[model samples]
Target chain A: MQLSPSLSALVEALRCLPGIGPKSAQRIAFHLLERDRSGGTQLGQSLLNAMDKIGHCESCRTFSETPVCDICSNIKRQDTGLLCVVESPSDVLAIEQTGQYQGLYFVLMGHLSPLDGIGPNEIGMDVLERTLANGNINEVILATNPTVEGEATAHFIGEMCHQHNVTASRIAHGMPVGGELELVDGMTLMHAFSGRKAI
Target chain B: MQLSPSLSALVEALRCLPGIGPKSAQRIAFHLLERDRSGGTQLGQSLLNAMDKIGHCESCRTFSETPVCDICSNIKRQDTGLLCVVESPSDVLAIEQTGQYQGLYFVLMGHLSPLDGIGPNEIGMDVLERTLANGNINEVILATNPTVEGEATAHFIGEMCHQHNVTASRIAHGMPVGGELELVDGMTLMHAFSGRKAI
Candidate 1:
């Protein structure tokens, strides 16, 4: 069906969102037009504000509105000198939700993918090297994803840690909490066995 | 986790979309921020334009940028004098896809539901009354949904057609084209039996 020009444009633009296709876009447009014009207007304003105002934190490369993010700016976290390195801002949020760790973070924004030409410099290793050389952080926790790219990125950062005489550790790769042993993958089971400690 | 003020506001506004909860809203916000900032900006403009410009078609009560929708403005459809009455604008699109009907449409935007305080007038029956009273429309096809409310609405409009001496018919209900008889519900099986036509 031929939609009104504005409606068609709205539907097409909505497709930029992850997983929304043409039929879903049409439904969303109609729903907004019919029942939630005020909500649509509010969403539009929010989108514009966020896209225009939000930028990466200078210290961590995570999304931020200011020069440094809240975690990086906290003096108490700075004193701990425990830096958790993650691949994205969402991972920072995930780790923060645990509330068990009290440390600052350095978000790479992405992991190394050599074929994609994402070298150490591409993932902000230069900034990381600068941070390490300053000697503030005692330990760097590599909490990037467990994929091959994440591992390669972590190994590269580990070498940087050794050069600066700072300790480097990787986040564990055992079965998830509340996951059954039977359901665990072979790679994870092997990691769990190999990394076992006296408990 | 405490998000930046703008990010928090964007997540909240994204909840206005249908079926999107907090997690989905956050995912969409982060996805836009990380991967498709341009799409987000374009979507923002589209939302603002659609909300500000799109209005209900005066002739059919369907969404339209102009006073009348494209279908209603077509001279040939006006000359046909066959008006299909439906519950919403999407229904107009559904029927139009068949390419069998060369007629006009009157969208009620909703069906009769007295429990929700919806009455004939609430569903634009007054406008429908005038349309039928005017001799322009020859046939009124009731194509409201097959719910209890839809049946009541169609019955109500059918009475109005009688008052105006206009022939009124209902869209048939039976087994859907691809539906199996074994899987069809009792109500629909009854409809199929009752609505069976002799070839």
Candidate 2:
């Protein structure tokens, strides 16, 4: 199984992506070489293109070609006066798929985990404060994930928003759609019960 | 929730690699931004570097930076006289992992699938024949996989080797080690029984 340095290098490069283990990387590299040469070529080109052309949007920390992302540049979206906060651009897409939430967004780019050495500043909390200080937003949504670090980050952001005199609220947490009562996890069940409101 | 054109392009680009579905692609893209900026930068660089540097080896059809592959360049390997013919370079690696074979290789790069327009020439059978016709080799082991197309390609190669007056033989077909008798498929069990030797 002595592969050349270049072949091994490509496999290693692919392994840098999340969830692509060694075996899978080898399989993929081999499959790409054998089956879809054009696709493999396109993938390599696209990777370079994205890295060279894309940068963080100054306003929301989202990936973009310009200084500001498309959402921040659009005049129609500017009037929403509401901003949703998320951990990543992918989460933005997931929420958008629901066809709800017509407001703008702020991407944290990461969650806070002190043990892992991730801090508030590392995730651009200062930029968020600056956005809130602009005084145009009517409300700020603390949409960080429900994990412990995510909750801690949400609380920290809420406190910061209070200093700027902006109302801050956490997104609702409860059972997922199509989730069964018997199979629901304890924390989710508790959240669902606690958050229940009269019809 | 709306992503910019560049962000969308990055996501789509990532999905081109095998086993990388849309969700995983987005996760990888975001994780790059959040966890390891340098690693992401390196990945982007490597993609371009590999694309610009790597191509198919003229001799074995494996990905190589040179006209002939490193394996083909090894003087020690050239003398082994045994030639293992496989469906792909990956198969060569798989057999090499066994640490038993000391031989050269001829990679078909794919099977003979006429429906898909892949024929003998497309899979580099001419290269294999010319390499064999040099008369330095005595044995050609048909190490193609056990699939239908693999079998047909192996048979076809066997016929070609016979026409060139070279010793041609198929690799062993048998039950895998640690395999249960009950779990073994009928075809495999029959082959194992038929191929059994005297004690």
Candidate 3:
């Protein structure tokens, strides 16, 4: 049976969200109708509130309630003369999961893609350069993903950091720990061998 | 990585939606933050709007924006003196896809499960009886799936309908189309044999 207009509109609207196809959208729409008004309200209010209240931190480009993020404002964190650059806030999360680094972050929010007309200026590379010029950071870790586009973006940023006299290093790209050698690709094998450390 | 309070709350709120497992919730939550705020806002708002505005049709117990759903309201439908009863709206969708049936629907929303505290009253069987007291319907098809609980529910509802002087019939359960007889369970084979048509 066809859903009512309101329910149909709701289902269509839900289809806009990532990974929610038409069927899933209809299921969610009907489920909302069947139950969970409070949850639905919370989600709606949160979306509007987040959109209206949250903005990028001036320094880190990470989401913040204020002009500066909590991490940027914290005085306890080491001013370790080291900065790690990444493309998205999710990347910051991935790095934070390791808990191995104590350093500042710079989020690009997007990668540099020349064919798609995305450039250094579009992705806030100029702001990054200015941040580097103003800060006392002597080392920068280019922790962008090892994909072709990510690598190109990292290389461009590393060159800019070099011009500013900062020691920049690209993050390693190799087979995951515990991965079988047979499963590892050739390019990864090459990098693993070339970057191997003597015990 | 740990999300901030706002982000974490958004993700937690999303968990209330059906079919959204923890992993899918996490992915969707991050995806919303990463891309398409307009789409996310629209989705969240629609969810709230649907939950706030939509309700059950008094007649069919199906979701509707009005007192009676479109299917129940339509005068064009051959009040064919037949009622196809189902456990859920999804079942209605499945039946509607066949395009062979042109009868009215009565959604029970769930089956009778005594162990789980679900009984005829819980599934609106009492309300169904009251509705059927009008004697508008001739045949009541018990289209519940052929699970143990479904069979029990069908039997109970069938008896109730029979008492009301309405003819009731349980839907056939057998090896599905494209299904192998060898792979069919013994209970299903038994059901198939019992429900077999006389050639």
Candidate 4:
């Protein structure tokens, strides 16, 4: 179907969002044009504002409007010697939601995907290594996801930390706190059994 | 967790889109900030451009860059005497996609909802009446959906057409093409049976 030029452009632009297909893009375009023009305008302005203002934190590489993010700057979060290394800013938020971690964070923004040409430098591993070598951090927590790439990235980071003589630990791999044993997958079961501790 | 001001604003702005909840909004915001900043900027510019350029067609109320839409101004679609009244601009697109209708369209953008205080004038019903009474139209197709409100709006328009001495007809309702009888809803089956034709 031949949409108006502006509408077609809007649909094409909307496809840039993750998981939004052509049909969804069309629906969103019509929705913006038909019911909420002002809201669409506001969204556009907000997108511009975020794009212009937000950048990676200098200390941790997480998204921030400032060079150093809120967590990195706050004196109250005093665990500067303990750094949790994560794959992305979203992972930082997830960990923050737990309220258990008092340390600072290092956001890689991605894992080491050799097939996709994403290596150590691609995910800010060089920056992480520099931070570790500079030496305020006493321990590093490998909180990358449990996927194969995540595992490889964690192992690489662990090796780097070892070379720097810093303690490095991986987050536990086991059944989730609320997960039922029957529904747990075999790999998780194996990990849970192998990593079990005596109460 | 407190996100940066611009990031928070972006997340909130993303919520304005239909079906985007807070979680999805946050994910999209992070995706734009972390992975696709250039794409986000392009999307922002596109949104602004679409909002600035697209407006309702003065004649048909469908979205258009011009005052009158392409369909309304096209010389080849000469069946100006046959008007198809629809509930929304999306409905206009659906009908146009069928390629069966050569007539002009009258978009209501909404059906008559007394409870919502949306009456005849609210959805441009007065304009429809004016068009019908001007003696240019001979037939009005009531293609408002099959919902109760759609039915009510169609009935009201049908009455207005009768008052203006123009023929009014409702689109057919029945079992959908290729629909299985057992899986069809009772209401649709009833409609199919009652509206059955001779083989």
Candidate 5:
């Protein structure tokens, strides 16, 4: 089914969003045009404003409107020597929401995907190396996802930290809190058992 | 945790979309800022362009860039005297996609919601009455949804058609095609049985 030219353009453009398929794009386009024109205008202006003003932070490579991100520039975070390595800005936001980590972060923006030709350089590993070489960071925390690509990237970064004489550590792999043992995956249960700490 | 000013603005604006909550809005914002900057810009431009160009058709109240909608202006439709009354522009699009309804439509833009102060005048029912009084229409088809407000609006429109000396009919409500009998709701099954016709 063909929509009007402007409606079709809106639908196509909306499909750029992550997880939004053609049907969702069409629904959103029709919704905006039918009932919420003012809201649609606001969303458009907001997108343009964000795209025009936001850029990567020089120190951590996370999104920021200024040269350095808020977390990177803040001196009050108590653990400046501890750096958590993550895959994307969303990961940083997720960690921040936990309110448990007081350390800085290095955002890789993506994982190593050999088939896609995205390697160390493509995800700014060189910049991470330069930051590690500065000798201020005493401990590096590998907090990438548990996926295959995330694990490989974390292992590579751990090796880099070893070479730089910085203490390297990975966030513990185990069953989640309040999760039943039967529901936990086999690999996670095995990892939890092997990494059990002394009481 | 607070995002950058523009990023927060983008997230807030994105929440205006239907079915999108705070978490989804944030995820979409981060996705656009991280990987699809160009696409984000295109989406922004498209929204602005669509909003600037699209307007309600003067005759049937459906979306159109011109004064009269394409359906209303089309000279080749089989029955110009058959008018379909629908709730919104999306409803018109849905009917058009079926390839069965060749008649023009009157879009109400909303149903009768007395609690929300949306009555006949609010949904352009007076204009519909004026159109029916023109004596060009022979039959009016009530195609509103099965919801309470939609039923009320259809009944009100039916009364108006009766006063104008025009024949009124309603779309059938029953079990969907290919639907399993056990899975169908009791009310729908009852409707199907009562409305059954001779082959």
Candidate 6:
């Protein structure tokens, strides 16, 4: 027999989540219908509110309900004149968690992916170039991931910074502090050796 | 730094889904915001619709958008005078997928668990008892999971069936089909021996 109409719709809709398969969708649907209707309703309302209100920061291209994000608007952070470039808002969150950096950010949202037809314009490179040309920033820290696409994206942005006469620096690559050398991948070891400095 | 209000609320609300933690919730929130706002909004509408409409089947206690679920409202299935009892509506879906069971069902929605304060009433045993008292069902099949609590619940319901002079049968416990005998658990092997049937 067919599942109840709304139940089936909820199960089908839940597959919009990244990792959920049919079974997981059904399980989640049953869970909400059976145990937590209120939570489900709350999530529904939250999703609607977020999708409707959350837009990109006009300055950094990161998620923000306001036109300019908190970090972008902070005079203290803006005065630092150091803009860290990265892909995705989650990276911004990670860097903020460290509480080490005291500057603003420029979120690429994605990197160059030529084969899939993604290019500089697709990832808001034009905006980054405009920010660089404004010349308020002292340095551009490219903290994009070390993957091939991330590297290519960083290289492209570095050229833009050079054109605008802004200093550009790629974040250092080395062995992670807490990782064991034996378990580390060969590529990481190679980078560690190449990037070594005197203590 | 604080996530934007709606973004943070979406992240918090996403944790209501089973198996989602803070990190996964954030990832999902970002993914939807960046890549699939339409899908996210669709899920929101679906969740609202399902949560608002879906309720338990009046007859079997399975999820239903209407007063009675499709299976329970079927005259052909109900006239068969058989009622299969299961712990959750998902089990009914599983059984329906097999295309084997031909009768109506009675869903407990949960099993007896004294330690957690769950009892017959919590599992809707009173509903089952009423169905039996109505004197329409000839047999009651106990198809709860094979865990210890499930076994105890089945036993309790079996006693209830006996009191009402209704035949009750637990789903067989033995090695699964296509399972390797050597790899089967010891308890399953023992049950296989005890439940062996002659061709």
Best by lDDT: 1
List where candidate 4 sits over 4 angstroms from the true fold.
A76-80
The TM-score between candidate 4 and the true structure equals 0.95
Candidate 3: docking tier: medium
Candidate 5, residues B1-199: lDDT per residue as tens digits? Answer: 5798899999999998999999999999988888899999999999999988989888888888778777887876525689999998778878888999878799999999999999789899878988898888899999999888998999999999999999999999998999999999999999999999999
Candidate 2 lDDT by residue in tens digits, A48-71 = 666677788899997778998777
lDDT, ranked from best to worst? 1, 6, 4, 5, 2, 3
Provide interface RMSD per model, one decimal: 0.8, 2.4, 2.1, 1.2, 1.4, 0.7
Q: Where does model 2 exceed 4 Å of error? A: none
Compared with the true structure, the alpha-carbon lDDT of candidate 3 equals 0.81
- The sequence of per-residue lDDT tens digits that candidate 4 reaches over residues B1-199 is 7988998999999998999999999999988887789999999999999999998888888888999888888776635688999988878888888988989889998999999999989999878877887898899999999999999999999999999999999999888989899999999899999989999
Whole-model lDDT per candidate: 0.93, 0.82, 0.81, 0.90, 0.90, 0.92
Tell how far residue B174 is off in model 2, in angstroms: 1.6
For model 1, how does the per-residue alpha-carbon lDDT over A1-199 read when each residue is reduced to its tens digit? 6878999999999999899999999999989998999999999999999999999988888999998889889999999999999999899899989899999899998999989888888889999999999899999999989988899889999998999999999999898999999999999999999989997
B101-196: candidate 6 lDDT, tens digit per residue: 999998898889999999889999888889999999999998999999999999999999999999999899998989998999999999999999
lDDT of 4 at B41: 98
- Models 1 onward score TM values of 0.98, 0.90, 0.93, 0.95, 0.93, 0.96
* Model 4: per-residue Cα lDDT over A35-143, one tens digit each: 8889999999999999999888898999888888889887766456899999998999999898888988999989999999998998998788888888888999999
Of 1 and 4, the candidate ranking higher by DockQ: 1
Q: Quick one: best DockQ, which candidate? A: 1
lDDT of 5 by residue, A45-102 (tens): 9999999999999999999999988888878652569999999998998899899989
Tens digits of lDDT, candidate 1, B22-45:
999999999999989999999999
**Which regions of candidate 5 fall more than 4 Å away from where they truly are?**
A77-79
On DockQ, the stronger of 2 and 6 is 6
Could you tell me the C-alpha RMSD of candidate 6 in Å? 1.6
Q: What share of the true interface contacts does candidate 6 keep?
A: 0.93
